[model samples]
Target: MWHPGLVDVVYATVAGALLSTAVVAARAGSPHRTPSRTALVAAVGTLGVSFLVQSPAARGVQNHLVADLGQLTGNGTSLVAAYALRVMVLHVRYDRDTAAARARRWLVALVVAFVAMTVLFLATPTVPGRFTSPDAPAGVVAYYLIFTSYLGATLVSLALLLGRYLDTAGGRWSRLSLHLHRAACVAGLIYLAGRVVALLVGRPRLEGSGQRFNLIELGVTILMPAVVAVLFLLGVLIGRGERWLRHRRAYRRLRPLWEAARAARPHAVLPVTGGGARLRLYRRIIEIQDAQLAAAQVLDAAQRRRIDGAIAGAALTGESAAAVREAALLAAGLAVLRDGRAAGGDGGPVTGAADQEVDLSAAVARLERVSAAWTGSPVVHRLAAPPEPANPR
Candidate 1:
């Protein structure tokens, strides 16, 4: 059997992680009211509350009434969480109207189950710690049965939904989160099954059966749900980490281009400051776009055609070819500005539709390509070079 102190430590750790995950999810979704975001936040937040109320530390000092109330609250919240998870998956898998209809039916069923469990608990005679004994009244047994049955069913349904969703999930982080949630559901089912067996067979008899039996019961009844909690926490962390890394990577990739743009038109730089990686990237893209417009004003048709011909002859394609051409044009314009052959146009920045309509990710990707070509492309290098000085005969 596991040491009692070690079990307490594990339980405490899992509870803390669950609570942290809930807080993070709530904050992350605070700005959005999309069905998927709201459902996910509700699911995680309720699950965290369930575990917190049922924790050993919280239950240790409670009187009989308080303990019973805590148990009912924990079980009710857990059921709600299960339903919310199902709704979240539904929103992901089906259209909003269909998902909403199905979710309403499930929510009604959960409410009924919770009410039945509460009524059964209240009808049972007052016992210390409420249902701690194997010989507890039939009312207590019925209460547990309803709670376990409804929760088990919800977990099974959630697992099935997640399995179907997993097959079609395209993003790496999405698949990972689904896999973690599916594993948590399986662990929840195991915990519920153990609750059912213990309720029917008596906990004392199971403990007296054998050391091996006791160990198995302890693991299934206690450790299984802890595993579920940890899995939920991991799912939250993994998704957050993936998004942070993507934003940070995009910010880094755009740095060289942003620098070039700043050098070319120092006066056009925006005065924005103090934001996260994603916001910084947005600012950088806008500044680079402003510089590109400035460059466009100085270049005549011949210079534009020459840059395009050079890119085409170099056998580049797609965004890379376009990026190289843009880089050459910008460099040539900057050269002309330096030589005083062409005016730098109006000090006021020119606004264009291309910056407003392109998707942020696509814009970042194209600019990243341009950044690479600006520094490394030999064809761009030749075109960006200043015109040769005239020779006198």
Candidate 2:
């Protein structure tokens, strides 16, 4: 038998996950609003609110009016959520004309189901604080049948739609999100099936004729929804999560070059603050650029020629070549600064003309390569190292 406390925890967790997913999806921006995006946000938000109302603590409230209201609201909102999900999937899988035509029919069906369920809920003779029970009245049974049928059909349609999309998904995150959404749909179907079985069989009876807890029923009611909610949440956030991870990796990779530049000319580092991984990385790049400019003041023509020769001899191409060339020059500049050999000459171009014209993403890519060469490339290390002097006896 499942513990009551554990069931409550599971309910709370599912509610929280759904709510969080709704917020994340709503905040995920696009160039402009679309039917798919709007439906997705609405579906998750209503679903989350349904779970919150049906939560154990909410149901346990002392007021009978609040408890009855919660039951009706939960059922009503969940119907809306299921309808919204159907609309979302339609928009995603079909063109606007076809999707809108189909969505109107689904909307009519949703209205009929919701109205029927609400009527049954009101007609059912139930206790003041309880709407659903194992030995429910025929009206209550009819109410649940409508709820489960609508929800199950919606989940099945979503599963089919997502499965088709999964096959054509181009990106890694896109495939992963589709896979997760399909899994959530399957879980929702299982939850619906379990509810149907529970409604039919009622709770198990103990030898003493007392009510016996059913683990399968508890799992279906509590754990299954949690699984569905978490999977859906993951699907919605997978793209953002992957992008954040990529930015973080880039930020870490650029640290070596960033540190070297900042250490050579501390004053060149910017005082800007308060940003996420991507923003911090942008600021770091700007600081490194400023440091390059500061070190350029000391770098002489002879050092630039030597660095250029070393880079050309390395036979690197594309960004690799650019990075090595930049690394060599920056190393030379830092050396000149340390040796107090401040030529104060016009250092000319510290980077290739092409480098200055690249976008922020390309600049970051090149800088990441520079960071790798700053500490790892043998040619860069050899060129950057100071010349060894020989003493005659």
Best by TM-score: 1
lDDT of 2 by residue, 41-73 (tens): 899888888888777667666235643656677
lDDT (C-alpha, whole model) for all candidates = 0.73, 0.76
Per-residue C-alpha lDDT of model 1 across residues 248-351, encoded as one tens digit per residue? 89888878777777776777887776766666777788888877777767766666677778878889897677778777877787776556675633332222
RMSD of 1: 5.0
CA deviation > 4 Å runs, candidate 1: 1-11, 28-35, 60-62, 95-102, 129-179, 201-217, 267-274, 290-303, 326-363, 385-393
Backbone collision count in every prediction? 0, 0
**TM-score against native, each model:** 0.75, 0.60
- Per-model RMSD to reference: 5.0, 7.9
